[model samples]
Target: MNTASPTRKPSRIQKRNRKLILDAALEVFSTHGYRGATLDQIATCAGLSKPNILYYFTGKEEIHITLLNGLMDTWLAPMREIDPEGDPLEEILRYVHRKLEMSREFPRESRLFANEIIQGAPRIGPHLEAGLKPLVDETSTLFEGWMAAGKLAQMDARHLIFSIWATTQHYADFAAQVRVLMGEADVEGGARAHLDMMFRRLLRP
Candidate 1:
């Protein structure tokens, strides 16, 4: 793994180059899908040579895996932000809005993750099972507690989360289709309002 040593801090240049490579790789992987993406494409995109890319990453798979793992964190951040002590419906609606913002701002990342999952998540399934599942289990328990206390509408907490993911990520993962159907309209804004209304109605006590 091209990891920084625990005892040593990476210099500014090293951090910059690594970020350049990863950002380029995200574009390539999102555009081509993992199986179709290549180190050469990433190198070209990064404006770096293959050797430099290799210096930062081992190969295409390593870059892809790194991107996927990092994306899991980005994907899970909003969920992690949920405040158990906050108002339940607002917290959940805030999650919905944050996810929509991610779809708008991180469309490429959304596509990259969607592609990985669509292809059976061969590169990142383990991370999903290990990281995503636990957080989801905990969130589900939280939702269950809220419902039991009459703070939320009773429903399958797991499916509620799944529904939220599907609805929000659709804007990013299916952007081409969305563009074709909706043209250059303010899609994210519309989605935010719609999702807020939908979830509010569904979850409000």
Candidate 2:
């Protein structure tokens, strides 16, 4: 029995309302996390009634999933820009810089994504497997090629990628701790310089 709902294109108002709901949902979900957030909270944040929020999204899970799916592209775009034709060291350092920039500029999105991963990614696990894994695998292959050519230090490509992720995201994910530890100093610029230096030393041929 095929009982799925038919899909229809959204009208102009529908588009605007959907964006409003999603923007509100991001704020709520990012602050409260998936398990802690509620439809009423999202509605209140959006300045829409609970019913109106539900009209745009059937439930909290749908909104969270939509946000994750949409943000994944932006999150992974830096790695996707690592060109094989470019200098290996420069390409990697550029990617690291872009990631650090993202952590500084999009801390909320980073935290939201981190929260999902910390909770075992119950909603996004499938998406990670189907979408993220292939991109990572391709990047890993590129890393191996660079290593084989003696352009990069011989290290585990996967671990190198993981280190980059952890180091860059730590500033954003632990912003409060970082702020307190660093006081009122320029944390972003300092971290950016430190990461650049660290990766350069680590990746040097």
Candidate 3:
């Protein structure tokens, strides 16, 4: 929580310690959730003392918020990459594939986000309203424009986005169940192929 002074650059040790705390906190919070996680657990996971964690972050909530804020940028990157000028169907399919890739590669992060959202995003609610809402509104308008132009099939743009999130994130948020059902099969590959076909058909003009 803004531990380092603004005027002075953080030392190499400070940088290393901060990274250790964040990486360890990600594991703890992802496994236990914000309510369940503790600074002691983060300290143990980081192999650092409790005091060390406190030095970097004010407390558990601060650490959790920092992680969520960083994750928000990562989570929104694919949506931000949506090009308004690109082919409507191709752009949407590309976004779907990118989202699936994130779920596969960052399962812990995905689950961490899912947990925050499911818990009503008490801490992150303001951030969501500020950051996420605008992006969604903009994307909805983009999708609506495409539909109006007959470039994409007519549908509820917001619900379409929500469906994309739900479908893609299921692979990560429910990874344990998916693994059990998939049983060593190529989960990401299958999901990508299936989602591509599904969205293509849905959005085809």
Candidate 4:
């Protein structure tokens, strides 16, 4: 009897290098904003030469915009999952949990994009209009369906979504305050509990 494991995947140094550049760019962009960050900083952060970074990407703006565009889909997906056909409170709470999970795992990416939006999203505007707006519209219709069915509380669906996004994203965007106020140990837990309580208050049935 064969007890061997599955086949190994191919090593992809170029792909890995590109990912390194993207990650380093995310950190740099988050900290310094777009105009403030330089190619040398990103190259050093990725431990690659500036030419090498350019070999993978044309420029810093390209990488930043690529990261922003990639993030748009993921950032929009949790809202897309808010099913009008499913249990109302449960669906909304699941979205809340997903957004929190994203905040935990991808804080730097969150900060990078947040920094862009705070400055008016020059690079991300088309992606936001073409990608994110459509998803929000779909989910707004879903929310409207839930409200009309009497499954959810009466509320402006778009504003409800806007508030949920603003509140959940604030945790990561303002993580410094969260740490100072709550201490490091309970930050994640406190966010979870606080979000639950807030949503429950909004969604009481």
lDDT of each: 0.91, 0.91, 0.92, 0.83
Q: Write the residue-wise lDDT of candidate 1 on 97-183 in tens digits.
A: 999999999999999989988999898888889999999999999999999999998999999999999999999999999999999
Q: Report clash pairs, candidate 3.
A: none
For model 1, the stretches where C-alpha displacement exceeds 4 angstroms are 1-7
Best by TM-score: 3
Residue-level lDDT for 202 in candidate 1: 95
Candidate 3 local lDDT, residue 156: 99
The number of clashing residue pairs in model 2 is: 0
Tens digit of per-residue lDDT, candidate 3, span 1-205: 4655668788799889989999998998888898898888889999999987888887888888899999899999999999999999999999999999999899889999999989998989999999999999999999999999999999999999999999999999998899899999988889998999999999998
TM-score of each model, in listed order = 0.94, 0.95, 0.96, 0.89
Q: Residue pairs in steric clash, candidate 2?
A: none
For candidate 1, the lDDT comes to: 0.91
User: Candidate 2 overall Cα lDDT vs. reference?
Assistant: 0.91
Query: What shift in Å separates residue 81 of candidate 2 from its native position after superposition?
Result: 0.8
Better TM-score candidate (3, 4): 3
After aligning candidate 1 to the native by TM-score, how far in Å is the CA of 114 from where it should be? 0.5
lDDT of 4: 0.83
Deviation from native of the Cα of residue 146 in model 1, angstroms: 0.9
How many angstroms is residue 153 displaced in model 1 relative to the true structure, after the best TM-score fit?
Answer: 1.2
lDDT of 2 at 178: 93
